[model samples]
Target chain A: QQQVKQSPQSLIVQKGGISIINCAYENTAFDYFPWYQQFPGKGPALLIAIRPDVSEKKEGRFTISFNKSAKQFSLHIMDSQPGDSATYFCAASSRNTDKLIFGTGTRLQVFP
Target chain B: DAGVTQSPTHLIKTRGQHVTLRCSPISGHKSVSWYQQVLGQGPQFIFQYYEKEERGRGNFPDRFSARQFPNYSSELNVNALLLGDSALYLCASSPSFGEELFFGEGSRLTVL
Candidate 1:
């Protein structure tokens, strides 16, 4: 079973627009939610992360809004740029396990 | 400081053959995890090791095996490779279990 589900397999946005991606999970034991950005031929880099205790966390232009009760979370990128065009993956993990269950991923493209 | 490093950036093997991939975690990191990413899909958890011990494992078949050294470096071995095994293998490291992970560039395996 897919532990984490992500929507909009691909996305396109104009420069400086707000790009949003959403993800949902079924496991309530998940406590750590993180977003990773991956470029072609490279590894996924840590972008932003949030815990269940916080409803929202923002870093630079990237923001993560998490809803524990709904078992949902979303990533928002403000002022999306062409350089930000890459694949984004959302992941969840529990304290008891070191494995991270990842979403299928969302490919984002920013056009100028 | 150096991030996670993986060896054999690309390899090709015939079906029914065997393959091995290596990884070196960052300094002071005690945990190492392996993931597999098929084309256009997110990474799937394979195994996790902490302090040279196996801490967690995914749902992969018995053909997949891994071990961690005392220095925290890890290796993933696959026996009787299948075409479905072709994918990008990733290694991630963290200071401990269930924390943020730093990923390596990954080793691409192609099964013929």
Candidate 2:
């Protein structure tokens, strides 16, 4: 069973626009939610993360808005750039378990 | 410090063959995890090791196995390779369980 489900298999956005990708998980035990960015022929890299305690976390142009009760989280990129074009994955995991459950992934293309 | 490093950036194998992929964690990082990513999909956790001990494993068959060395490096071995096994195998390293992880470039295995 896939614990986390991400929507919008592919997305296209203008360079300076806002790009949003959403994900929902089933396991309530999940406390850590992180987003990873991956370029072609490369491994996924940590982009941003948010814990259940906080409603949102922002790092520069990347932001993670989480809703604990809804069991959902969304990643928003402000002023999206061409460099941001890549595959993004949303993952969830519990405190003790080091294993991460990942979503289906979303491919974003930012047009210049 | 240098980031996580993986070996043999790419490999090609035939059915029924066996292959081994290697990974070296970042300096001072004691935890390593393996993930499998197929085309157009997210990464699925395969196994996690910390301090030379297996901390977590995914729902993979016995044909898939991994071990960590004393230096925090790891090797993933797959026996009797199949066409379905062709995918990108990624290795991630972290300071500890449930901490921020750094990923390597990954080894792309193409099973013919």
Candidate 3:
């Protein structure tokens, strides 16, 4: 019953490089897709999110590429920094469901 | 401006004992959700509450229960703790539910 699937349990990226994490979900009803970043002993903070209507969304150093047909989404970090070393999670949910189906998770390490 | 807050950053309990975790949502946030994160795994949804009413639940057993207060704070109670229950219990709050959650640092429960 793993509803959301993520890849690469752990990843290593060099500083100034790019780090990517991917996720796919089984439930098509999922309308909202979000990525969260968590540091040790801290909460999961919202990084960026993309709805099904948008194919892609971008922030300062983060981007969310979404594919509606594939039921997949990915988070890309540009100019990865050592400060970006943390665990990342992808989640899916629909309106009124309240429950968010999360992927296994990916630990990203950006070496300085 | 305060974010979600959790109580007792760490706790130790014996098997068959009980533990209670607390969470206070961000200011003006009305929905509270709970999640469990085991080592090397993603967070699994446990429960959600909106307006002091149950909104959703996950596939956890009956030993886990939660409730929300009028102030949008919530509590999670687990009875008869098992070794498998040793993990980081997370609390999240949102303006509504499903997506856009602000999470707490979490309460780590170690069952012996």
lDDT of 1 by residue, B6-104 (tens): 999999999999999999999999999999999999999999999988999999999999999999999999999999999999999999998899999
Once fitted onto the true fold, the runs of candidate 1 whose alpha carbons sit more than 4 angstroms away are none
* lDDT tens digits by residue: candidate 3, A36-57: 9999877788899888999999
Model 1, span A43-68: residue lDDT tens: 99999999999999999999999999
Q: Pick the candidate with the highest lDDT.
A: 1
Which residue segments of model 3 deviate by more than 4 Å?
none
Q: Higher-DockQ candidate among 1 and 3? A: 1
Interface RMSD values, listed in order for every candidate: 0.9, 1.0, 1.4
Candidates 1 onward: DockQ, in order? 0.87, 0.83, 0.80
Worst ten in a row by lDDT for model 1 chain B: B50-59
lDDT of 2 by residue, B1-112 (tens): 7899998899999999999999999999999999999988888899999999999999888999999999999999999999999999999999999998788999999999
TM-score of each: 0.98, 0.98, 0.97
Instruction: Score residue A68 of candidate 1 by CA lDDT.
Output: 91
Of the candidates shown, which would achieve the greatest DockQ relative to the real structure?
1
